[model samples]
Target: MKFTTLLFPAVVLGAACPYGTYAPEEPTDTRGVCPMLNTLANHGYLPRNGRNINENQTVQALYDALNLTPDFGRFLFKAGRLSNPMPNATTFSLDDLNRHDLFEHDGSLSRQDAYFGQWSRFNQTVWNWTTQYYTSDLLDVQIVANSRAQRHTRSNLTNPMYSLSEVGYLFSVAENAAILSILGDKVTQTCPKKFADYLFTNEQLPFAVGWKKSALPITIQDLVTTFLAIQSATSFPPPPPDDSSVDIFN
Candidate 1:
């Protein structure tokens, strides 16, 4: 993917607290983090799935599933208020891990957090090639928008954060578009033709491609399916070059 070096404004971004603090009044038997972890495992993103669906997700488990480093967690704590630890802390305690439902199955995921993870992952890939991804600066901007201004913007475009449904839609629209833009046509053409066509046709209307409306809560299944689809489309190897032609000079 092509990397763009954009100037990031030096601004301190505040973090927002999780959705809610109170324990849920009603909990369902099937509601928990296991399904999400299972989906990731099935997709080869995780090693195995032994977690119970009814149990809350731990900080370490989340980081592991997302393939994020401890430094990234510290960055999130410092920038997004997603987590809080003692000053200069490297790991999360049990209290810090269980402090919010955002880390649990019962709590819904926010569009901001979802965008943060997606962008971070993409930026990491870019960083592997070049040191100009501007991930930290962009994350600071997102934190400011998500927490201080109550808005979520990416690539300088304003987007909403109603729920996980919105997150899915944004991922389908903005995130995919950003990837396509960064990778350019040459790289994107390597993906399955049908998948590329689907993305092109549904670029504007996410619901047409199975993304639910913004009001509905996106299930773990939906999130996993979306990620799997993206992985299948974007992570495939390119076709080998034709070697049938003989060299005239040789």
Candidate 2:
């Protein structure tokens, strides 16, 4: 199925948490990670109400929630950098990381960590596939350019002091660029022409209205809207028809 077909439903379904279930008293705290996680959960990117706002998120938990372990492992192998292995021989989970204190269950996930993880996952899935399948170099260029365009300092993000808008802006920029690069010549055909045009012009995405304004903290709603916009613009090739003997994951 198309990437949008496969992933958009997840984003939509993420909005179905039981009423008043995981609503934190303060959902806009820049220093807290709960709002971000809650946003992801509510939008179907993660399990709804799976975690509390103040609970520390382990690297393993994040990877597991995102379903990135196996694919990331495959990417590492293809890059000729697969060294360590997780307990399960068939997959690489974050529990294998060598940092003892960092890998602990209660280890606080830094904003820097979240950004790097997102970068790695986006590189492995979108960038690598686009480069290989379409023989394109646009994604590589965008990745390099975006790395320099980042406005937030590592200290600020790592200290977990970022507002919701900051993270949303960062995500929108990187993700929009990735979508544009991957679609390439087919962008106009695949996505809404206006959305594609906006991305091509490097204009600020309309979805980032309020959050893009200041250092103001963000709410789950802001994240949801941003994600929905990104999802709406992305399209991927359809998967092959299923057959009992065929392995779809491969």
TM-score of the candidate numbered 1?
0.20
Q: Model 1's lDDT to the true fold?
A: 0.28
Q: Worst ten-residue run, lDDT, model 1? A: 13-22
Consecutive 10-residue window with the lowest summed lDDT within model 2: 102-111
Candidate lDDT scores, in order, read 0.28, 0.31
Compose the digit string of candidate 1's lDDT tens values, residues 1-250.
3232222221211112121111211222112122222232332222222222111233243354343344433433332233334565443322232332334211111222333343211122322222122123222222211221222222124323323344334333333332222111212211122322232322221223342212322233333343444444332234678777867578
Relative to the true structure, candidate 1 has a C-alpha RMSD (angstroms) of: 21.3
* Cα RMSD for candidates in order: 21.3, 20.6
Query: After superposing candidate 2, which stretches have Cα over 4 Å from the reference?
Result: 1-40, 50-86, 89-250
TM-score of each: 0.20, 0.22
